[model samples]
Target: MKKTLILLSALTLMVSCMSKEEKMKEAEADGNEAIAVKSKLIEGAGKALQEQGKAAAKSASKGVGDVIKGINSGMSESISQSDVIPEASFKANFEECKAEKIYASNDDKVKKVTIYLIAKNDFKGDLILKAFNADKKEIGRSRLKADIKKDDAQYVDFTFDERTHLLQTEYFTIK
Candidate 1:
């Protein structure tokens, strides 16, 4: 029973490191890949228990899953680190950006566009902001803070200089 608990606990830890998309794929894949991943985790845990002399008290059972809610919250707060943009961040250029009144004043000067996202509290996934042109040209984008409220998950700030072009935007929610 101890061995069984240890094996399952270790598998949980390893699987925790995988992204949700990968997990979905694993679930959809044939049993082979699943078994391999499971086997690897079990073997690793057994080794740790032996070498660490039981000092390996970090139970896989109490890993990221136990505090998943908090861990994701922490991840959201740590989103601006350049390498961790939630997959839900992007910009799409579309039509409204050329709607006469808005575009008439838009020249060609583009200073910069920062795209990001802020996850709504309790919201399953991150919010998405996209910018599109009249021809659906992806112009620019930026996500809000990772830890933003749903009511505040919206960011459509389009900035330009004398060198930017008329850019339209389309916003969507992604979970």
Candidate 2:
């Protein structure tokens, strides 16, 4: 028993006194293993982030597409329901003192009227617009101000109940 114990202690001492090169080689192997594990973890995290970015971009693109479709549908509906009125130009002078018929729609389908006036010279006064139906009955009237310099243009817009046939204009002094 005494001889066996002595031999085991000698073997343990020899192992504890291993060469410096051998110990260094073992430590380097452990470091290489740890680095490989860390590299795999980093690669996995990068892949997850890339997938999340792709998903977010796809969702945002879908949202923008939906908004554009809604706007286009609304615009199409409005254009299909409204009627197109022809543009008309009229000229008026203070000395003429005549009521000019600017526009006269053949049918009773007129819903809105727009009148444009270009000042021949410097003039600051009022203009009266009268709307008549097919039966020659006054339906609507509006007053517009011509506070414009020479060669400048002014617009007068009128919206009525359902229909108008004729739009006449006459110039009057500012009171």
Candidate 3:
């Protein structure tokens, strides 16, 4: 009977030790899985933050470029306006026709002249515009078709070639 009791006690101890070992192994496996999941989450969060930063930087760069373009445009306009000389003379070679307004428009490396005319007689012909410098030297010339009614007004635009120095004109004549 004593031998039987000892044998049963040994069997119970062995079973308990095996159960504890299995439980420990399961806990270790769960811990490893949790660590792997945490690593993936961290990596995903880092990638998301990096993408946001890139987008923000790109937007800021575009905004700065637009501002610079606006400033350059403003400066060019101011410089062009200051270069024009007021009190420029304009002569019309038609009877009872008066030169009303003359203005110079500047473009990229070129200049254009616009003339407003008022007449009391019906006229239809090709109008020749000649621009001269302060020294009376002819600098530019352009021809445009004009059709003016009696007691009415007309606007004529003369576009000169790129080589013409129309921007430095001091006087002009229309015939």
Candidate 4:
């Protein structure tokens, strides 16, 4: 009876020390279950975020569309063809001069036009003023010798009464 008890104990110990193949299979089953649970959680989170993103995008698109529509309506009402009269007055730093439209009288009987220039620095150049009619045709032109000191403002006048309604002015360095 004692021998039978020892044999039973040895058998239990052997069973407890399982084979490598059986241990590997058990570990694989546990790993696969963990991976499946993690995958399910990740998929659920991703779907929830995707739905939120879609809703946000739809709301943002509607807001942008409303703003664009408002701008278009405002522009169409404010800017008409008849309101596009020739511009008047231009002031800027005169370094490296360029031609610029000054004023539009829209009156063919305008006898005199004046251009005002303020010299931030001492300047000596030829200032040219040109007048045009409603048809964009040049009607009169005048050139003036400019010799101005800093902080000086001068007016260059042109006698123009030949159906000229628009004025453009430019300046060039005199060599």
Best candidate according to lDDT: 3
- Measured with C-alpha atoms, the lDDT of residue 26 in candidate 3 is 93
- TM-scores of the models, in the order given: 0.22, 0.29, 0.40, 0.30
In candidate 3, stretches whose alpha carbon ends up further than 4 angstroms from where it belongs are 1-110
- Which pairs clash in the backbone of model 3? none
For model 4, residues 1-175, the per-residue Cα lDDT tens digits are 9999999999999989979999999999999999999999999989997989789889999999999999997764333111112222223333222232333345645445444566667777765555444555555665667788888876655555454433331121211
TM-score of 3: 0.40
Q: How does model 1 score by TM-score? A: 0.22
Off by over 4 Å in 2: 1-112, 159-175
Tell me how candidate 4 scores on lDDT: 0.57
**Candidate 1 lDDT (Cα, 0 to 1):** 0.44
What tens-digit string does per-residue lDDT give for candidate 2 at 1-175?
A: 9999999999999888868998899999999999999999999988987989789888999999999999998865443222222123224332212232233354754444455555666777665555544454566655566677777766555444443333321121111
Q: What are the lDDT scores of the predictions, listed in order?
A: 0.44, 0.55, 0.66, 0.57
Q: Which of candidates 1 and 3 reaches a greater TM-score?
A: 3
Ranked candidates, highest lDDT first: 3, 4, 2, 1
- Write the number of the candidate with greater TM-score, choosing between 1 and 4: 4
Lowest lDDT sum, 10 consecutive residues, model 4, at 80-89
